[model samples]
Every structure is written in C-alpha cells, then in structure tokens.
Target chain A: MTSLGRGASVALTDLEKSYDRVAAVAGVSLDIRSGEFLTLLGPSGSGKTTTLMMIAGFETPTAGDIAIDGTSVVGMPPYRRNIGMVFQNYALFPHLTVEENIGFPLKQRGMPKPERAKLVGEALELVHLPGYGGRYPRQLSGGQQQRVALARAIVFKPRLLLMDEPLGALDKQLRENLQLEMRRLHADLGITFIYVTHDQEEALTMSDRIAVMNDGLVAQVGSPEDLYDRPSSRFVAAFIGESNFLPATVRGMEDDVVVAECEGAIVRAICPGRPASGDRVLLTTRPERLRFTDGAWSSSAPQNRMNVTVTEAVFAGERCRYMLQAADGTAMVLKEPSSAAIRRRAVGERTEIAWSVADTILV
Target chain B: MNLVQAIAGRVLPTTVVGLILLFLIFPIVVVMVVSFSSATYLTFPPPAFDLRWYKAYFGNEDWLRPTWLSIWVAAAVVILSTLLGTLAALGIARLPPALRVVASGLILSPLIVPVIVVAIGIYYAFSRYGLVGTPVALVLAHTCLAVPFVVTSVSASLSGIDPRLQQASLSLGATPIGTFFQVTLPLIRPGVLVGALFAFITSFDELVVSLFLSGSGAVTLPRRMWDDLRFAIDPTIAAVSTLTIVLTVALMGCAHLLRKRAT
Candidate 1:
C-alpha cells in the first residue's frame, strides 16, 4: 500500500514562513527519514503547526522550499500534492456516511465501484472499525468519528501523512490506545509520518525523533533518549520532561566535565562546546538523576555533593518526590522509588544529594 | 415551589397570550362571517344563509381568466425568486465578513423601501419597453417585489448551517461546483423552499404593484376585486376574498411544515 515504496525522506531547505511580515518559521531546515515517526513538538505560535501545514501544502511559504524524494513542491496545490492530513477537529463530511466518506478519495481518482469498496473496506479494517460504514459521522462517538476520519485520510495511501494534533481531542485512555494503534499503523504502512503537538509526553511517547521548536526556530532535533539525556539548548532541557534549573558560574573544567557554582553550592556537569573560565551558565539536571546519601563525598568519585533539606516530600504512587532547598535557597527536585527506606527520609529532614558529572547537561 | 402558586404564575402569562391571539385573529373571523351574510353589505352576522354570491363568483368569466393568469404568474415568481434568491444567498454566504453584510443589505433593501416607489418605477420602465400590457410586465413587477422577502428568509436560514460542511467536501476531493450541489444544496434545502414559498405568496397576494403596472386589458384577481368593490359592497367580492383567505392559510400551513422539516 506504500505508494513511494516505504516513502521518500522529506527535506526542507532554508524553509521560511511569514504571515503579514511576521516571521512564523525562519531558516528552519530538517531532513526527516523515510518510515520514521517524526513529531514537531512546540508550544502554540512556535511555528510547529505552521511547518506541518506548509509541508501539507495548505499554507504558502514566504521563502525557501520543501521537497520529497528530492523534488521541490513549492507553489503546489494541496490536492495536487498527494499529502494526507488529519485535522484537530476531525473535519468529516457530516452529510456523507462512513462508506461514502472513506470512498471519497477513491471516487475522486475515478476508481470503479468494486475496487473503491474493496479499498475502503481495507481502510476501515486498518482502523478496526469494520462493517460500520453505513453510519453517519454524528451517530458515532468522538473516538469512533476520529477513527473514521483517520480511515478517510489514509484510505488512498498517500505518500506522506501529516497529522496536526489528530489525537489531541480524545480522552486520555482513548488517546493512549490510539497512539499505540497509530504506531503500529505507521510500522505496517511504511509511510513517513510527520506529527505535530505541543504535549511533551505525546512527543516523547510515539516519536522516533522529535524536533523541539522555539521562537520560530528548531531548538533541537534528536531521539527521545538523546533529547532527555543530552539536550543541546536551554529550551530543550526545560521543555522535554521536568528539569531543575540552577543559576551557576563555571569554575573549572576537566576531561569533558566542568565544575560550577550555584549560589554557595558547587555542582559538576558535562558542558557542550568548550567553555572558557568564569562563564555564566545554566546547570540542568533531571529529578531522577540525583541520589540521596548520608555519608561524605569520595574524593575520586566523578560526582559532586550538595547539602539539602527536604522541604516537601510528595508521594506519587510508584515514586517519592523530595523538593529540597540548598543553604543559599537554590531549589533541587529529586525522585526516588517509594521504598520504605526512601520514605523514612521524611520532610523537614536534612540530607546530602549526590549525582555523577555525566548526569548533568550544562546549558 | 408551591403547586398552585407556580400553576397560577404560568397560567397568567398564557392568559395574556390568548388575549393577544384573539385580538390578532378577530379581523379574519369577521371577514369570514361577513362573506356568508345574506345581506348585500358586510356585517357581523347574516340575517339569512345563502349560496347565491358563491355561485355568482364562479360564473363570472372575467374574474376567472384573471385569477387563472395570476396563479401562473405567482408560480413563475416562485420559480424565478427561488433560483435567483437562493443563489444570491449562497454567494453572499461565501463572501468575507465585511462584504457579506454589505451584500445582504443590498439584497434585502427593497423590503424596507416603499412598494409604491417600485410600482411607479416598474410601470414607467415596462411601458417604455412596450411590455406594460403583457403578462411579462406583471411577472417582472411581482418578481422584483417578492425577491427581497425571499432573500431575507434564505439568508437567515443559510446562516444557520455549518460552514465546515463545505470544507469537508472540498477536502474529500470534490470540486467546488460538485461540493455545492452534493453537500451545500442538500443542507440548505429547507431555506430554499421557505424562500420560494415567501416569494410565491408575496407575488400571489400583491395588489399595489399589480394596480400600477397591470393594464386594463390584463387585470389580476386582486385587480378584479378592486373593480368590483368600486360599484357596490357585493357578496360575490366577499366570496372571492374568502377563497383567497383559505388559499393563504393552506400555503402558510405548508410553510410551517417546511420549517419543521428544517429542524
């Protein structure tokens, strides 16, 4: 069913988008591999959806070009572009039944009845809503209607699939179920999937690689693990998953590691790009990265120690989260498995939190 | 929350509504009562029952011809106004917000203007083009007067439909004209029917424009009624008026059914 035979990689070269002289996407260039689940993750007005719409051929770019299979598609109409789109509202034709709506694209291409019905049947089965083609859109629930819309979009098997918050309208349980179904569909269909959303967890869950956008520019593009472990920018570090920010000044550098001073607390981190001495930097670390200990720090251990007081200890089912404060009031968040031993370190207790230099990514 | 208190509260408003309804329907009841009067003049009640006036109206050949012509002219008006007004409403619905208001105002402006003004203008225009004594002049004059009402009803109903229905069709790969016929026309069917009914009734019941534009050789039913009223308050004219009232009530009933279908 793959028209391009596993689909050609999408590439945008110096793509710029502007509306009424206000730059929405600027000099943004990304090469998305074939059969990859790529999600453009950003907050509203951050140019993520604009980039998707531009790729879908709905909106014209003020400058630059987008190409599939190395062929530029500038000034191409949406219908002629052969790109499938799933909108946020699930814009289904209310007057048409499920069968007719799914068969619409096939009918447009002048496919014969037997062939069109056969294809529509297959599309319905793909979304697991078989034998319900006679129903109208309004008769179905939101999730059912969304599935029909999805079936309609992919019924013709377009070369590239563009989804703009397609599952954002569904409830949590249904969204999660559809997310897994969508991943399987992507694998089976073998088409390049370009999804856009502002939800960080959604970006991390279904995406093979995420392009985290900020201020009309791509802040970082990497796999979920790469983004979480080694974010290249301050925005990425803060945007994906939670992170504790420490205002610090670089004090020393040794073997890809740098020692920094956060208020009176000294912290060690891995800095991207060589840094000069006394440079002001943002020290970033995840909640799960820190370990609580009662002993003194080892001299040879590639870790730093900060004396902290657990101001708030919140229980989160599987994990216990401690909101700690340093002597100088620099806040630290730490998460640990809710073991009996961990719970014993109750709130308003003083302790030492330690983490290896590799756990931190200096921004 | 008291039972009798709440019941009384609702009944008082209903009582007021019933009073208003009586005030509005009294004139039509009086007209019907006087149409059957044995006396030659209109009164609250007849001294004796008679069918002579009804028989006289059916026997008059002059009234019969004009009434038949008026039926076909009103039908022509319905057909013309439905097509033109529906298309105009659809066109205006697609216009940008600022232009939509302007287009709607232009289309419905005739309703608020004086009908006599349109009658004089159409009379001179039809006479200048040698169409004054013909049926075409009556059709044209009636169509012009009825179109604004059609436009008003159509635009109101058209605004109630979902605009995304059109977008969904276009995305489904249907062309613009195909989408309009297959999707938009079906969704706006009730509006078109209502507009047509308004056009037909307005043209059929019209007297002012027909009086000005209609020549002596081409009198409509209302024109014939006017001529009959000049010499005497005859029972035959009252019979004709009663028939007209019945026809209107039936037409309005159909309009009500159409509105229900829309819902």
Candidate 2:
C-alpha cells in the first residue's frame, strides 16, 4: 500500500448550517494545519458532528466556503474530495468480506485485481487483523469490525481522514485500546484528522488540538493543556473538567496579573483578557488546585485564604474529595491525593482552604 | 400422573394447533389424491391409483394453453411490478415522514380496496378503451395488486440498512450511483426477491380479476379451471391444483434461500 502524501490543510471560513429554522452549526471558522490531529469536542447537539460533516463535504454549508490545501471545495461532492470517513456505527458493508470491504475504494477507482489484493492484505495488516480477510463483518466482534472500518478508510491513502465518534459503540476497555491504535495510525500515516466526539477524556488524550464547542459555536480552540489551564469561557472551564467558579469584580491590573475582589476577599490571579476596574467577573480554579491550610490559617498571606465548613468527604482510593461551604454559603470542592494523615473532618468543622495565585484564573 | 391427566396437560394447545394444520392441509391432500384417482369423476380415495388426469391435463389444448398464458402473464407482472415498486420504495424512503406515510397508503390502496371492487373498476376503465381481456390489461391489473407487496417488502429491507453505509461509501470515493449499486442493492436483494415472488404468485393465482376481465382471447388457468368446475367435475383440475401447490412451495423455498443468504 502506498503511504498517504503530505496531509491537506483545511480552512473553513464562516461555515454555517441550518435545518429549517434551527441552526445546527452557527458561523464556525477554523484553520486546521496539515498532519495535525484536531478534535472537535462537545456535548450532544453541540454542532461538532455537523462541523465534521461539513468538512467531509457530506453537508453543504448554508453560508460559507471551505478550502482544502488552498483550493475552495464548497460545491464539490464527497466522492471527488478524496477524503476518508469512519462513521459512528462503523458502516462496514455487511455484504462484502473483510478484504473486499477494505479494498472498496480502490475497486471503485478500478484498481487491477493483483494490485488490489496486495493492498487489501497490507491494509488488514495495518489494523493488526492479518488473517481476517475472508471473514464477513458480522462474524467479527465490534472492535474488530471497527478496525476493518479504519482499514477501509485509510487504505485509499486519502489526504484527510474524518472520524465521527468511531469508538462510541464499544465498551470502555475496547474504546481505550482503539483510541491508542488510532493515535498510532495518525502518527504513522501523518494525515490531517478531524475527529468529532462528546467524550472529553478521549478528546484530551488523543488530540493535538481541541476545539471545545457549545451551543452551535466554538467555545475555545487550543491544546489540551491550554484549554485545561486557561479556558477563556465558563462553559469551557466546566465542560473540559471540573472547576469552581467564584463571582468576582475586577479591581486592578499588575502586568500579567489581575487583582479581583471575590466574596469579600481580595484575590490575585492571571487573566488572559484584561477587564476594567469594577467589572463583574468570575474567579475559576480547579478542584485539585485547592489545598488544606493544615489549621495554620494566619501563617499564610490573608488575601488568598477562605474559611469554610466541611460538609462531606468522599474517599476514592488514591484521592479524597471534600465538599466545603464558605462563610457566605458558596460551595466548593477540594481534591487531594489520599494519605494516612488525611482523615474525614467532622461534619460542620471549620477549615481553611488556599491555592497559589498562579493557579487562580479570572474569566 | 395418570395417562389421561398427562395427555390432558398437553391436549388443549396441541389439539388447537392440530386442527388448524388439518384445516390448512386437508384440501391440498384431497386434491392430490383425486388427481391420481382412476375414477372418471371427482372422488376421494379411488379404488385404484393412476396418472390419467395428469396425462389429460398435459395433453389437452384447453388446459395447456391457459397454463402457459398464466405463467407468461405472471412473469410479465413480476418484472413490471418489481421495477415499479422498487423505484417507488426508494423514492418514498427519501420523502419527509408525513408525505411518506400518505404516499405509502396511496400506493397500497389496491390491497385495502376489495379485490372484486378493484376488478370491476379495472373492467369498467379498460372496457372503454377496448382493452378488456387482453394480456396487457390482465398484467396491468395484477401489477396494481402486487406492487404493494413489493413496496412493503423492499421498504422494510431499505429501512434495515443503515443510512451511514451509503455515506461511508461516498466518503470513501464511490459515486452515489456506485454506492447504490454496490452497497444498497446487494443489501436489499432478499427483500426484492421476496417481493418478486409475491408478485408472481399473486398474478398467477388470481381468480376474481380474471373472472371479471378475461375474454375468450385471454383465458387464464384459473378462468379455465372455473369453467371446468361449472361444466363438469374434471379430475384434471385436481392435477392443476397439485401442480400449483408444488410451484408455490418451490417459490417459497427460493425466497427462504434468498433470506438465508442475505443474513
């Protein structure tokens, strides 16, 4: 089998789609680099799948243009676009044996018999199913069938590959296994991949870049660390992982840091976007960022501490989560690695929580 | 338990199913017995066994002519109805749900309308154009009756195929027509075969429409059989019935084989 050439870069300019009066994807513009594994991550009905369909050319944008490798392909049909897609259901042709299914694209292009057979065998080997060519899709397990689908999609050596939740139907263990395989395939093939999924952990684990979508619009697009550490919106902060949002007002700016007043206390944090003084904002921090003061409340600086009552504690083997309520009744959860010294505090016992100023974010 | 009690435990459902089976098979068995009878008139369990009626059925021009006519007419109906019904099913499957339901009901109206009523209506319409009793008229009428079966069967098969298969084929660089031929058609082969079988059988065994529409020019097998029953108790008609039973069983076996291969 021939290796895929240098991957195609895609540019979606002001892409939008609507079904009757309902907007499925609303005004999305994204630049995808060649050979990058970009994931469109979101909850259900969040327009991620629609965006992928638009890129695959199955969907015609209601208003906008799409270009592949600097050439506009707005009205082009999917077949002529030369892209590979793996559907959520796998969509392996049930009538064809595994070899025929993997060689379908080549067969359509009228590849000769001997060449086609050689390529089909090579494609099967790529998916680690070397001897499964004669078996029908129904005879194989779900994971094996999925691998066949992957083999079929990539056997044509298309410039781009799009996957719509390809492992959504498999069990957790199998899904994780396939996720690693997919990463290896992407690396080996070195093709642009635009994957759509609602599973945040899968997106975080496999993607070179992620575009977290919300309500038909892209909320944020960045690397996994960029999104986790510096989410630009409340929706991104909450959707990517767990977070605590505290209401605050911007007080002043100091170089890269912004001082904010939160819950009758002054908190200093790094803000990517500057806001005017007295502007209402949210102070966001991750659950793991918070730490127990170890009863030395007055030893630390006064501005970054909160006195709270422990309401509930859950022990989860390696880590413990403590639910606490501040003096004004704002609830927050703190997570720390489990240890012999850590014990469930008595219900209603007052405690102090603190975090580094660098970890706090003003959104 | 005693023998009576043990038997009683199974007797109720077993007896019910047995009666139903007997009710269905008894007439066919009697027809087969009479077809081999040595007697001159229709009778059950003749004193001797022979193939006299079978020989008569094959040798007689009146019976042989109509039998060939019915076979050709049913073949024509199968081809015409399968083509029309498969196209209609594909088109209807793509329509919006509300319109699809309405279109399906309209297409299937012949099955819901009384057969005699449809026959009379067709007779009235065809009589005006001097088309009554012609092979074309009969084939058209039977197509109307059989298209619904084809539609329902093919529609069911089309629905069973995941729509994504077509999308995947296109995404893998197959054109729309290629996808339909290579992916959609093979997946729906069993349904189409079953539908064609139903169309063929419906046209072949139809009696009421032929009774209303058949002239001396287009005497179907059932029309000739009806005439024979009215004029005389010919055991040759029994042989015809037996042949039809065998044909139907063979057709069913073919359809079953198709379904098995599809899965």
Every model's DockQ: 0.44, 0.84
Model 2 ranges with Cα > 4 A deviation: A1-5, A295-303, A341-346, B1-10, B127-130, B260-263
The TM-scores that each candidate's chain B achieves against the reference are 0.90, 0.96
For candidate 2, what is the DockQ?
0.84
Note each model's CA RMSD in angstroms.
Answer: 3.3, 3.2
Clashing pairs in 1: none
**lDDT by residue (tens digit), candidate 2, A263-337:** 777888878887999999888999998888866644343237778889998889899988989877788999999
Misplaced by over 4 Å in model 1 are: A1-4, A296-301, B1-8, B33-41, B47-60, B150-164, B235-263
Best of the candidates, DockQ: 2
Per residue, candidate 1 scores C-alpha lDDT tens digits across B1-263 of 68788778988789999999999998878777777778877766778878777887789897799899889899999998888888788788779899988887887766767888878888888888988867788888888777877777777787876655555555556667777787778777877888788788898888988897778767888988997889766778878888998998888888889889777
Q: What value does the lDDT take at residue A131 in candidate 2? A: 96
- Over all chains combined, what TM-score does candidate 1 have? 0.90
Clashing pairs in 2: none
Q: Point to the candidate with the largest TM-score.
A: 2
